[model samples]
Target: MVEFYIGTVDEMLQSTLISAFPIALLIWMMTKQRALPSHIALPITALLVGLIQLFYFHSDGRLLGANIISGVLSVLTPISIVAGAILLNRVLAISGAEAVIGRWLDSISNNKVAQLMIIGWAFAFMLEGASGFGTPAAIAAPMLVGLGFQPIKVAIFALIMNSVPVSFGAVGTPIWFGFEALALSPSDLLEVANQTALINAVAALLIPILALKFVVSGSLIRQNLVFILLSILSCTLPYYALANWNYEFPSLLGGAVGLMMNIFLAKANIGLHTTQNTLNKQTKVPSREVFFALLPLGLLIVILIVTRISPLGIKGLLTSTNAWLGIDIGGSHLGVSQSLVVSLENILSTSVSWSYKTLYVPALIPFVLVVLISIPLLNLSKTQVKEAFFETGQRIQLPLVSLAAALVMVNLMMLGAEQSPIFLIANAFATLTGDSWSLFAALLGALGSFFSGSATVSNLTFGGIQQTIAAQVGLPVNLVLALQSVGAAMGNMVCINNIIAVSAILGIHHKEGFILKKTILPLLVYGGVAALMAIVLS
Candidate 1:
């Protein structure tokens, strides 16, 4: 067993910082050098490190096995969902549907403040719900860029919007990976996660206004108080309500509610606000036509929700499918028991057997919906559709590479390190804080985000550390881990990897430090709130 090592406060701080420094340096060099693309750097690093584990560490088997599993997981589920989402976005983009939708929103209130509230907050959240793993940034950042917003601002806004839906992201991956895999009971896990989610939701309420200030400054906040307040309420209230009752659907349904609320609020305020010269109104296309053009997205949302929730909606189809996969666990060894295969006969078999239902689709709802809706709306020739598919394939290439590389790196580090790196680091932290697990949890949250390059991944990595520490200190594990995860997400706003990626996307080089400086407060605010929650709730 990997036991935690308690050390002096100075020692803990030093070790934690040192353990994190290598990854930090990589982030810095990638941003500074601007030589090789990160897509290439990441995999190269993974391979080099894996080689070290093989030769020097004498831990090649475990490390290599971890890499294989992580690699497979990267492609198997999350990657598929991301690809489907991007394909849907591409369809919308190609069809000029995005412009129409933007124009219609622009029509309701041409005021820049209103537009920011709608787009930065509501629209972004909707994308977060529909697709969580980097899609919000990929989709929303470009739209903001087209809106004449600064790229740095767009990146910042996207990151902020990205936080709210993270717990339920990618069909509940975080909750599944972080909480479910633990020793805790399901009800306890759900309650803890939901409470943590509610806290994050409340923190996210300020995002619209904060993003506006970052994008347009303080004046915009003052100018659109009603709209902004309403927007925040619309987002937080329903999100909290849905999360409490239906944790599975909170982010998904909440995003749609927020989007609709923004639309309604915008339409109601059609002539209420006087425009400032700095914030000009964008032109509008016909709302109904724009809505029609977005039929694919609407269809996607409907189908995903129905297929996931409404059993009767897909009951007959699910009943006839007998496809399933599972690794039969024996002793120390494991192997793949089934491989994924698709056949028309399998598709046909779904209509008559519920036992075979798991094989029926596997979230093909987005793929099917995108193709069906885009064909008519995009007015694409067969050639154009084929090209779109090709483009979609190309677009996912970097993500595919990045995901695989990230998995390999994470797995290697986890398996080959001399100890549970996080545990060693956390024990050092606990000793330093005199068993103040809140501080340790906060620090773990920050550390996990730094390493994993994702809040959700961070949660999965160090959640147990926080829980373990809290238990040792006789504090609440759920609250501490909850805070850890929330702070982890907040930490993403400033993580070197995230900063570099967003900076590059926004065409901002050398100003990453500046962007980090700007975001530092929000990160602190978010973390501070979570830390306070850990303290007060305890």
Candidate 2:
């Protein structure tokens, strides 16, 4: 195998431009006036990257094959999660649970803004913590749409609200696994987590405000300003506080606390005085109906918490391989785990590998579990369950293509090793920014998530680069890394994969560009806030 390097300024400039062309092409094709659907645009963009890797970057077939295979397998994570969410949504609709849940929410508050804050912000925060891989949008968007909000608005708001909780999402995988390569001490990692939380706490003050603009009138927002303020504080305060203690549980616990407080406030009609009369007009929901309607979600949360909260010991058991098999072919080893973990290592005798922790992944345990449980709990009929599964399959067809192409492009770019396009782009930005890298650190993080669609992936890819740049520019490494985490979280708003997944789950097609356009501003605003905090903290 041959490797490429940028040894000269001219070579660096040339390589960077060549590397960026695929991403630039993707953006243009997807966001142009006559936008191409992601299913079409992404494959075309991926083919172009393959050409670039082969001709320009001089990648060999072995590396390309491994990356392509790994990329295709990677699609299973998000697709399965989306499938579970869609199935759950379908089951709810078929069993009339959707209507009951909607009425239950309305019964809490007739004010649409209040409902949006609870579901989109608080509820989404919890879901992100428990199940990060774009699950918040997949689950929340459908619920909001069922509540009569426009699908597009629900999608945008759900994406935006999902940001603050992401760095700590999936039990803080973005921090713990993301920076595993750096081998930072536990205390140092906690510091990074704390700083990331602080930056997000500041952004949280305005994120919900920005998200609300998409759903309600300016006057309606103004009318609920007090409730909005309380709602924002309700989540961020605990979220910020918990990050000081540990990395894993802030988003989960904070969102839980906020959810309870916001529900109480909404029920008590405090700060919702203007809408109290409308709430009064709504009929009360029977406790049993509400319980049955919410049982699946409640079970999901309990299971996720039990499994994810390391102290309970279930996470290790689920993630561990009870048995292992290793096979050698063509001087490469293929190791397979026999239990809950499925791993493929050294693909095609190359260094590339992929792993799927079957039980650790929320798709099987909670999401699918909830879907199965809902049938019996909600007393759903066999015909209804069949329809739900069929609809889920129909909705995911195009998204599967889009996700596969996007990830193949991402893996190809990433597996280019030192000469990877993404690395070159980040290097160029840091070199250009120099002393002001703090201002753009989050943007680099955002770029990683924009391409790869996971904050954890973004951090894994660029966390070391960020640390190097921070030391070279004499910035605090912890603060700069925190910025990376913050940017990655905000990147969720505009992630192409997330847009496609949400669109698929919402039963909307060809609106990826519109959602991207709506989301970019929020991403920018969140990035700006993070940059300013980094500067001030330093």
Candidate 3:
């Protein structure tokens, strides 16, 4: 195995620039006036990265093949999650449930700003915590569009609102699994959570304000300023407090509490001064109709909560791989289990592997289960069910390709060499920034998610690097990790895979670049605020 030597200044600079070219090309092609469609641009980018890995990085054909295979396999999780969300949207749209949901929201308050805060901000926050694989945008964007918001604006806002909750998203996977390789003590991990929550809490204030700008006029936002402040505090205060109490459940419970509080405030018209109640003249919806309309989503939330809370033991059962059958072929091992554990080990005779807990992934257990259960409960005709499935299949086609390409690019960059391109870039940043690396620490985290499409993956990829840099630079390690986590969460706004998924779910194709243009500002602001907060803590 040949390592690209970065032991000298010229070598480091050369390595960093060479490694960064693919990412630069990707962004340029997407955001240019003649914007390339994600499905097109992403594959081109992936091929470029693969070529660099093979040539510049001196990677073997076997390693390259393994990484490509791993990338394809890894893509299944996001694609399935997106597919399930699309299916649910189809079910809701076909069954008239979406209309009922829109009206239910209107009944609470017809103020568009209030509705946006409740659903896009608070509701999306809770969903991100419970099921965060781009699921929040998948669920919330369509709901907002059904309420008469533009699909493009809704898509942008959904992605932006998904940020603050992401570090603790999927029941804190970003912390627990993201830092698992660090081997931190429970106490240190808790401190990371606490600092992450504090940083997010500060960034949370600006994020809602920014997301609101996409959906509502500045005048309308000003009219509802007090209510908006309450809305922001409702989530962030509890979110911060919960981080102190435990590493998990800050986003989940904070969003839950915020949803309830915001609903009450909106209903009472507290702090809502001038916006007219547009639904006031409409007849009231029956309780049963609302219940049935909300049933599938309600069930999904319940299932996610039940399975995630460790005391319940359901998470253990679903994730357990204790019983399995093992086999070896082509110098690789495979494990198949009755409990739905599937593992592939030593791919192509390299120390690379993958595993899928069939029951544990949110795509299968919650999203897919909710869809299946909704069929009988929603009482859809066979034709309607077919239509839903057909539409879901159609919508997922481009996103599947784009996601696969994006993940392949990510894998090639991260796993193609003993010192991958990602590390080279991080090292370059640290070397260039030196004493001021604090300002750029979060940017490194954002860079990770920009390519990899996940906060958990971002933290896992860069956490050790951030810790090492912190030690070398005389900064606190936990604070730096927290900044990394927060920056990764913010990166969700501009993540190519997320942009692709949200655009797909909204049935708005070829506007990924436009969405990225709109979201990049928020990402910058979020990283800036988080950096300042980290510096303060330091």
Candidate 4:
């Protein structure tokens, strides 16, 4: 067993700052030097972290080795989902789905604003329901690009919108797994969901304004305020209601239902597309072509719904059983046993057991199924299939390597938090806030997502701390936890892995800093509102 070296707040603070050096270096190099994270920044940071653990912290090679191994293994599920998304995009691209989708958009709306609300806000909400592990942007950003929007804008918009629906991501994983893991009762769980829904509802309504002003004219936004207001309500109302009734279906049903309502309105040319413009000029296209174009998305949605809601326990069938291959390090092994945890004293409190679940993950079935069926249904030839696969393999090479390195840094920090910078940062925040921790509740939540690249992991890190702080400060535990959940959900907008993946998928290539700069605006707005709401609600 590794000895726990308990340090004073001052010593821990110094250690934490030193530990943060790697991250600071990464940011400087990414933004200032324009270096590729995968090739240069990330690898260097990982090495520096390893040295920090070994020399400064005196952590044994075994613990450091386990941390690296666990960190690499942790992203397998997301990496699998991303690979599927990339494959789906590549297949769709070669199959001429974009042309059919473009015609479909023409048939629906000529207005860029209208298209964004549908694709950026509503459509993404549905995908978020289906798979919350950063897969929504991978799927939705390309769709918006097909509609003639800038890839960067689409990436930013989707990333921001993705934050609001994340509490219910992958079928309420953030709440069901993140919060419930804290041992809250049913009543407490419901309360947390309720407050969380409220926070997201506010963000949902505001994101459209940003999407409009940025994508369209400000004058257009002012003219379409009523329509925009109604559109937001159309989504958020159903989302909040379903979150209370069944957290699993808010994004699923809310997104699907909201899309229908908005589609009906857009078809009538209600807002910016009130007159058929060049962007949405009517084109002669067959209904069958439209359906064929949408078949892949159709398959994805149907598979998600059936697996998610079926009483036959399809979700369970897919969710159970880990494909764990253990990592051996100094008599301690780490692996992907979803429910199993490996804890090392004064190191990671609980390291998740993980393995490549190519067969069981929810994303695998739809993406794989879509690709296989598309070969016949979309009339894809053998040449096209090989090309798509080859292209995807090449495109994903940099992102996978970069993502793995970044995740390693995060895991090292999170698992060894007592001796990491996060500990110092959290303490500093607590000291600064005192009785006012509620004010920064959401910001802290966002910070977790930013570091861990997951709202669920954010909750895992902060839920207990939030609950304890709430107790000491005389606030409702559920309310504070709700703020944490909502804040972390918003943090998804700026998660490092998310930015990198979005850039890579959209072919932006090493513009993580630029993406971060664009996204931080909405991150601020969302966090600001959550902070204010926390003050009142908590």
Task: Go through the candidates in order and give the clash count of each.
Answer: 5, 0, 0, 5
RMSD of each: 6.8, 2.6, 2.3, 4.2
**Compared with the true structure, what per-residue lDDT tens digits does model 4 show for residues 313-431?**
77666555453445655454545445232222222433344444444564468887878888898889999999988987787788888788888888667656554556556656766
TM-score per prediction, in order, is 0.77, 0.97, 0.97, 0.91
Candidate 2: Cα lDDT at 452: 94
Candidates sorted by TM-score, best first = 3, 2, 4, 1
lDDT per residue for candidate 2 within 215-256, as digits (tens), equals 888888888889888988898899999999889888888888
* Local accuracy of candidate 3 as per-residue lDDT tens digits, 252-297: 9999999999999998888886536544646577889999999999
Best by lDDT: 3
Ranked by lDDT, the better of candidates 1 and 2 is 2
- The lDDT, on a scale of 0 to 1, for candidate 3 is 0.88
Ranking by lDDT: 3, 2, 4, 1
